[model samples]
Target: MASGKYLSILALTGLITTASFAQKSDADYGWVLDSSKRSVKNMPQQNEFLNNQYPYPSKPRSMWELGVSGGGSFIFSDIDPKFGFGGGLSLRKSLGHIFSVRGSYNGSINKGADYRLRNTYDGINGPWNGNYLIYGNKYVANYRTKVHQLSVDFIASLNTPSIYRGNPKTNIYLLAGYSILGADVDVDAVGSNGQPYNYTGINFEGKRSDIKSALKDKWDGEYESNGSIRNESRDAIGRSDKNWLIRHGLDLGAGIAFRVTDRVNIGIEQKFTMPFDDNLDAVKIGSANDFISATQFRLNFNIGNSSKNVLPLWWLNPNNYVYNEVNTPKHMKIPTPVLPDADGDGVTDQFDMEPNTPAGAAVDSHGTSRDTDGDGVPDYKDKEPLTARDCFPVDADGVGKCPEPPCCTELREKMMAKPACAITSLPSVQFKTGSLSLSATAKAVLNSVAQQMNANPECKVKLTGYYKGSDKRSMQLGWDRVNTVIKYLVEQQGIGEGRLIFSLSDGGDPNTVDLMGTTEEGPNSIPAPFPNLQKSK
Candidate 1:
């Protein structure tokens, strides 16, 4: 029993040791793009560099596995009763992905009793003294129970999920292999004489000897033996048989694991195994053949950091708990007309031709819009929006017009046709009824003429003084009047001398006489004065 316990301990230790060394191969990590930044300074631009962007992260650590277990097993198809409790430990390690090695130890107690007849000549019996006491009577015989298999195995673990799982964590699995089973078996039995049938054919009286000799080697100071009983009529003890046992088996199991911390993890698993070869039962009782079966529960403490190795499945991984597909060209979203700021310009780029203009850019009342040309007229309406020269143009009379280079002839014709100065001032200057000073108001008008001539620099006027006359004196007075206007225009008024043109006489059709004094008549007395001095181009 002590030895079996020791074997279990050794198997567990071996499993741990063996599994600790298992590692994932580089191939298992799949392909990961190298992401190191380029160290070279400035280099010539090349098409290759244009296509290259960023690199993928590298695989970080090695992959490893460990496990422990305990359970009961039953041995079958053996002559000796094959029923017992058993338990063991197993460990598996992956060595660089594709290949791995594993080792384990298992122990069991297979107990059963055996019975048979041993005919011995000169076998001791009750003394025949004083009545010829018959010798051998059938005696009951028995053997003490024994156990088997301190076992160990070394095998390769195959079909692992660690590779594809990406996570160094482990999951449910099945393991199968062979084991090297070793054990010591001692069989003990007691023997006794049999009774005779017909008065003297066999000894009827018997002395059964206690068979202590069957006690062979002891484990932890306890006798190790297989018990047996001989023919039903015998009562006696028998010698013990000693031999070696070998175990071969199949292991099947599943387990789950989680990272307790970075490199360490705790795992719990249950396992069942089928032994293919006989254990100590075969050596003790030659005809005994048995198969071992066991169930076990274990806690696996693992030590290994997570691997940075990328797997084919890495594309599906999410860094966070929430997951979804992420697309790039980050800002390309469906556009809305109301929010025309497609480029995210505060000033909707649609209305603002210069979308990216600096803030506080000169604009129309709608603050976001821009004025590309600085002209008072905004670019939107200004024909020659950029030039200050495109202002309103004034005609000769100092009145403004819309079109450029306003038609001076059309404006002059319109004003002249009105008879403002033509009929009124011209006729009035020819005072028919009086002297050069016709009336105080008329004098004032003449004075205004003088002031106008004085103010005008490059202007010229023609003056023809006229009157109603029947004699030369009136005619002469008209001349005197012309002289009076000329004197004011050229000398007193400072009008340029070359500009004044003097004329005399009626200045109108002489045949048309002035119907002077009456309100209804004159030399075509249109309103106040005689008609003359019309402006001509």
Candidate 2:
């Protein structure tokens, strides 16, 4: 049973490790600026001669996080929960920019008490009265459990930086883990004289607070009796050892940390643990399981040589690669632009295949002399450049042997006709009031518009949304509708985003959008007019 429980802990740790490395292959994360080349493992001076795309940068061996924490703990069982003392030591390593694995060892002294007296037939979580008859006819519920635990926690950072941001100084994260729990639990059943506690003077008719006070005044504080231990839970794990019982526990926690310096940080954390077995409070009342809650303040230290390792990845933004390359050319290869139009041909010499051409002669896009007719002469020298195929054989002066054919006139005319395309009768798309959602009818209308744009590839569209007053809300709603339509057309209907123009019309119905063909040019999209309003899609 112990082996099976340990295997689960291994599986969870392995899964997190595998996912972290998967991102290392693709992310543009921060690389340690190690000019010394200790991490290169190759010739140090070779990096100076490398091109923009040479050996890939290596991930720096980052520093591990070590922390110590001390705080109050409480136990939840059948009786009322009371404050206790707990502290722990943890070692953590980052798996990726967002995920990390932490291992912690902790110890706590937990205590709880029940004020109500109970009999054999009493409920509300009362142990068997006959079993503890050696103590007294009526007894109160209480225990003091000293626990030791070791756990493996996985943490996910919520605010790891990406594009448009730099590294973070404060981190918020959530965590969950698996733990092995062991505790020694005991109850105060006997008086200071080493005999069963006598309950003759205790008043049963007072308020719960008053009754607890009376019980405390009449008895010694030392727990002299052994707490009731669950026979089955212990025997299943291992042989009984002293007052300690062992069980598998699950932990959930969250915390925030602030960087104090390059080597240190401070944080406050809270953790709750459930050990599955209900014997934590030294009671087997068969009512509920027991759990522990701890809230601690931490002082953490970074353990590594700062020259070799970067701060943990969770503090690094992954967009520094793009941001750096745009502003500087330190690691970039930029070819000098080659723009020389030789022979006055209008095409660059690098791309022009023909080195020389007659002055003022018409040429194709490639800068070669144009041969309008299929005859062997260039247009600048040929007298006739539009000879029909039937008149193919021409003289040296480029005059066709025969006139244009009468029977081929209609065929030539038909070939000269352009493709028929018209963006007529396109439907307008409507949106829900004060929303970004498109209705079924609006989608059907937009689909028709996409088909027309696909047929007439040369056509651009203007999508205009209406607004009431000139107030910010009215204008922003119009802008939102136009933006939504353009996104739908480009994303869902496979239309090019550049083909849709956004517009807004004042003093009209705020829920309607109009689509029309446009020959005028404008920006395809625009920024929102009032951004503080809620947004939806």
Candidate 3:
């Protein structure tokens, strides 16, 4: 009936906790969510290393588990085993998500008896035990063992959550370790008369339960006689002539725990203890070693200040923070995607090779007017698309135009002019507003310009830029653009300094620097009219 009340209290506690957690939202943690402000580092950047760019958060410091336990400890040896009471105290700590270690001290009193009476000289019973004393050779086996042990155990958690679950309420684990033990094995042999009880009247051939009942009536419950142990290394307690057998052993076990709150939990565990020596029941009658099995119920508490530390690692899910972040991010800084379609075309500026595509004009996915023929002209402007080739250059209306035949006088004039350059029309290089840096597309266009300039040494190139106002900043922007183009041709393209012209004029297209080749003489590098207006380099 008391168990029922305890179970009801546990259920009510969990229900209240779950309801309280369900009330929380992202806004509830607003007061405590800024990891940057709570950083342990001196500088902001050092703390920002794990902020929004990375998924990890600083690990919280936690404390060890302190436990108190009690249950039954049973022993198996030469005698028939019966349940005994046991209890212990332990401390545990986690090294990581999966492993932990525990230190424990425990003790128990276990008792057992044999129903079939036997002679001390029988081979199966070995030689007579000194615990019989004056009781002589005939005896019924009855014994009680006292044990105390200290052990260090390595524990492994079997249920570390790797998916998106809240902290687990139940933790299951397995453990294995070595133990140092001291046991006092004794026999309840002599009766109150100071002589072994007479066995002649007791039937050794009756049913097991009936024989056990008869043996009980003839015996005393006192376990005052000590069983013999190896004398060389054993220690006698107080003034008693009997000594405890020192033994080394192994403990193998598993357990499960249920969390009642952030600070407390309860667990059930069982351990099978195997001792190296066989003196646990007083007699070394058989070759098999003795064993003890302990089943325990543990109540554990976490020891630490609530404001400074978290619960033990085994109770916290490793994936909890990350899963919540992806679903409802609180600390992320993601920029909105900006897709500017300046010409009302169905494309963004970044991929639109043809800007300012006319409204109501049919265009391809690149925002360029489609052309059927392999000519350079768009279908919207081409009158004779198939006639558009190198020899048949198209006119403004896309009509084929024939070149005038070269006369003798024209040929003589060209020869006398010495070095006449034949260069094609070059494309304009566009820049982002207020940015002087050359983009990859701009650099590729200039590469073709350099190849053409290298082929025609006598050709002089003119670079022209435009600005809206006469203010120093506006004019300086235009000066920077024209000067930049001319420098690229002279310094980067290996063109002579005298072969390039820098021209800055009133508005045409503020973002464009037009390139054209001619024979005009000009200065290649122009001084910045307003150096103070220069933007970032």
Q: TM-score, each model?
A: 0.33, 0.53, 0.56
lDDT score, candidate 3, position 228: 44
Model 2's TM-score against the true structure: 0.53
Cα lDDT tens digits, model 1, 301-356, are: 44343243222121112121111112222222335646464433233445545555
Between prediction 2 and prediction 3, the one with superior TM-score is 3
Q: Model 3 TM-score?
A: 0.56
Write candidate 3's Cα lDDT for 193-293 as tens digits.
76666777777888888888888888787876665443234422211455667789999998778778878899778787898676787665668888887
**Model with the higher lDDT, candidate 1 or 2:** 2
Per-residue lDDT over 299-400 for candidate 2, one digit per residue giving the tens place of the 0 to 100 score: 999988876677777877656665676767566677997777666555556756675866555454456766656687876687766666777698897767
Rank order by TM-score, top first?
A: 3, 2, 1
Residue 506 error for model 1, in Å? Answer: 86
